[model samples]
Target chain A: MNGDLTVSAASKDTLPTVFGYIGIGVAFGIVGKAAGLSPLLVTLMSIITYAGSAQFVIVSMLVTHSPIFSIIFSVFLVNSRMILMSTTLASYFKRESMVKNILVGTLLTDESFALGMNKLNYSDNHLNFAWFNTANVISYMTWILSSLVGAVLGNFISNPEKFGLDFALVAMFIGLLYLQLISDKSINFNLQLIVVGFVLVAIYFGLIFIPSSLLILLVTLVACSFGVVMKHAFF
Target chain B: MPSFNFVLLTIVGTGVVTWLSRITPFVLLKKFQLSKGVVEFLSFVPIAIMSALWFENLFVQHIGHLPSIDWANLLASLPTVLSAVISKNLLVIVVVGVISLGVTRLMMGM
Candidate 1:
């Protein structure tokens, strides 16, 4: 080995993710702490679950005293996209050992997976487990630390809602929803918006008619089907 | 403080389910193939879920009555959605949304 430090392409694109995770992580922490969770629990969530939106949903659910099974279902639904990511990654990991696949899979995230896939498709980066895991670990540690910072910061705020900390989750979702809309270049902007508008209206009515715990899952399923059907019908 | 067990279970349970979903495709889906239709449908899940979550929190619902907008959040959403569109950055959008909401709440004498 030359002993010269070389930044793997897998890790190079992680700078944006570092900043992204910290902001979201801290927001999650403040929101969690605002909901009466211990700072330690907030940090543990960052360390363990590591999914941003899902964590927010879980915290809000906990505040409402939702059933435990319902909370788990929310996690599963929010994170089901990981299945698609893992499926795409499986092709790349075929030659690697099962142990490596297992370990790497555990660390898979939207940013890291996107980085690895983008590099594989266009760049010359050698995506070894070391490089891949390095990306995940960096964000992983950053998330936990940022969440702790927010949790500690949250202690000083007498009323989170007054400070708009409660709106943080909703704001984050709005941002994320926009991100999702643009992330997939395959789908045109207009079409995605139509679907979003449809889903929003459905959820509004669904909230009134159906049990929310059940409505969320059903709406997601129905909306996706509607999107697929519309996509085929249009394009 | 919430019951220690409930908090622990939620965290651990979510972590398990999340990790399992991340790894399941590697160990199990390797042998099978997902149809293109299924993948397309899956792509829409995030959009649908995010929209649902956003709308759910944006309004205050009443049984047998249409949900009314939470004016504070709705007003705050003006800037939030704008920053999200203009900057297209999560951190920026969040900062804008938080500051805007905080200001709105203050000005409204909330």
Candidate 2:
């Protein structure tokens, strides 16, 4: 009975995270179409690319008729973060079979990482691999299908911009960030405020010196390192 | 440069890069264990990167000038943020943000 209850509770926590990926996936699809990519191309990108920010950047480049080499470089730069994500997972997956590890690595995304990391927190077992794979598959299917739907129907809609569908992506990220904020409730409000201020400053400066993707990486690393150092020093 | 060839090259190029970024770490780390400090630093990378990305989108202009305060993006972001705070469900927040932006744009004669 206790085992069953635990399983049920775990599923409850994970189910919403899975569904969130679906919604995010759909939003990506809609936005991809608005950016002028074809449905087939959008689907292929979702399947092949899997990283949301990279996909968005790719579509933006496509709409602007960027050269092929530029698009490739931009995608490479945007996805550089995945190297960190996969590396972290490597430590936890030391015991898993090679095939399983490769499959999971291919499906790694922010949502999948969150779910997998949360599960890893509770158990020392390898079964978290299965859960991670399951969540990724669910998220992947939702993203692909929703993107296909958006691509096919996107043309009929005369004005997606008017409806503010573009804001969907922003709102989704905000919601995800809110969750991160709440999880670390002990964080000082004053420090949080300062971090926000610094991010804005970074954004202003980042626009001048670097591409948006790299700017994000640079600011995040600097700010987060500061936050971590402060936390250790003070608390 | 045929379109079909362009598509094929994109797929292959992206695939190769993606696979290498993901696979290389595992292969290298398999032989050597990561130090505690390294692990701790890596754990924070995602949150930092995501924040930077989100902040950039919220503030930067995609096309010409930064979108005006009167732009659909600014007008729509208001409701979208509200919906996210209230619902906390991805679908609800997305639908609300998109629909609200659309309706507001129509009303504003944009």
Candidate 3:
């Protein structure tokens, strides 16, 4: 397939994700601001990271005064799934030029990858460079703009707690996790999630004796192994 | 606020690391050809990671002490999970979360 820009239904499909990005991005920005990061830095973080859960976790770590190494390590761990997404997306790129592939890869986010991949399996016409890039660009801009607004708005929020800004991150995570669990319809998949969920909380109980920085990473790996094991056993 | 330099460094550090995770396979891999076992293992990573993140946020992890649940977050999660189930939409779930937490704290007077 030739790689000229095509723009048919892409814009229409991107509208819903734009709304999601704006909402969550604003939540992240306000939380970042309340954690004492500047509006510019919050917006910059959005531009650079383009990840929802990772940025929120980073803000929480920053609030706790986590070391730089720990923070960087968390970013990698939190985003390790991106590697899989990139590899899967690469399969769809076929013979596309390196420039197109690299640029697309750099802009990949959970939403962009899911949306683009959703279309690719349905129709070859749905995933040209133009359609995919339009979706990514739209989401990227909405996220950054919303973050900037949220951070600026955060300055006026003398009491972030009363407004429930502190709980937003927790809520966001739960929302995302629940969404991930339900996205697949298989009962075994749900059971896998439940297995991982139990493993996670059970290991997190060790936080009393172990530092969370270590526990978080360890718990994620162990829980995933458990999930994979259950996948073999049940499915 | 953190020092400008520290903030800048964090931005750059996370950016580079995260960017690498996103771009490396695109540059190197020609296809998604991981072994079945590897793919299955990788598939579980998000479930593991996201659940851990959710649990951590819902509970206050105290060093040298057992974790305590954040009542506000715990309270908000009921409605948030419901919204996720009903709408399967991020925007709806998040909006429900913010409002639920705000209402819970208002009632608790915390």
Candidate 4:
């Protein structure tokens, strides 16, 4: 332990995540507050759930007074990717104690998971629970605080798009995809990934009745299968 | 407005379900040994999920409806994607995207 002062790898690695979370969190807060949710409630949801897309679903479903069970189910389906993420991450942890895994898993979100996995996939860094936990805590605080700010200032901003915050996450994901694609040496062109992704996108467009969350899950499943099947068939 | 109790239940219920999804894999993987084929299949999940999310944001306006050629998003994304491919820096990509989107919105009087 550092008797003086030192920055951990988790904190350093999560700096980008802090920025990403803040943008999305404020957007969530503004939308929640605009939908008539109390600021305190919005903040509490951020603290407790800490899931970005699911929180948005909660706010919309609340406005419509959708059935509670259905809301939970939708959130579960949307977040099912967390399972795959955690599975991928489990191999990186130095020691996976029950308590450590529980605490670390509690803080898992898509962005942090993606960033951490990218680091693990490309580099030889020794990822520990402390690193993942630190990223988690920083990201958690960023989201809660930003969402609170958004909720408090929700009345002041009528159109979030005027500031161009709406496109923030899309830009972040594009950057991430680029990073992942360049790091891999085996594959030159992502023709297979792009083809599979576009095919699923077309299906999603055609089947409007299916829930987007469920559609994402199905797309992932089918695409992975297709990728594996093609790999087996050709090579 | 819905009662406080109802909102609380919704939030708590949501938190529980979400946490369960996050935790279940870590807990269960301790006991189970996944097959080699399964791991290989799982490797592609990240790219798949990321692409699905990116397309959803770009091509879909509402959850159920197709986007009617979101010119602003499209135009902004061009430079943004170019920056990502060329610079490969997160900050640069994000800045280019936001500035481009802002400029497009201004030019279109959005």
Name the top DockQ candidate.
4
Model 1 regions more than 4 Å off:
A1-38, A49-139, A165-173, A176-183, A211-215, B1-10, B63-65
Write the residue-wise lDDT of candidate 3 on A2-38 in tens digits: 2233564666666656655666677777788888898
**Candidate 3 local lDDT, residue A30:** 78
DockQ of each: 0.52, 0.43, 0.53, 0.59
lDDT of 2 by residue, B1-110 (tens): 22545755665677667667777786777678998767656655544554555567655444433422335655666776687677755557657766776787788887
Interface RMSD per candidate = 4.2, 3.8, 3.9, 2.4
Spell out the clash pairs found in candidate 3. Answer: none
For model 1 chain B, the run of ten residues with the poorest summed lDDT? B41-50
**C-alpha RMSD for every candidate:** 5.5, 4.5, 5.0, 3.5
* lDDT rank order: 4, 1, 3, 2
> What DockQ would candidate 1 receive versus the native complex?
0.52
Give the C-alpha miss distance for residue A129 in model 3, angstroms. 5.5
lDDT (Cα, tens digit) per residue for candidate 2, span A8-127:
444454455544455456666777677766677778877876666677676776667678787778777777767877887887777877777888788777666654544443454233
Worst 10 residues of 4 chain A by lDDT: A1-10
lDDT of 1 at B14: 91
* Predicted candidate 4 versus true structure: per-residue lDDT over A30-148, tens digit per residue: 99989998999999999887789889988888889899899889888988878878887766552668788878788898777767656654455346676678778898999999999
**Model 3 reaches what TM-score against the true structure?**
0.73
Residue-wise C-alpha lDDT for candidate 4, range B1-110, written one tens digit per residue: 47778888888998998898888888777667778888878767667766676666655445556544667887888998999988877777877877888898999999
User: Candidate 2's C-alpha lDDT?
Assistant: 0.64
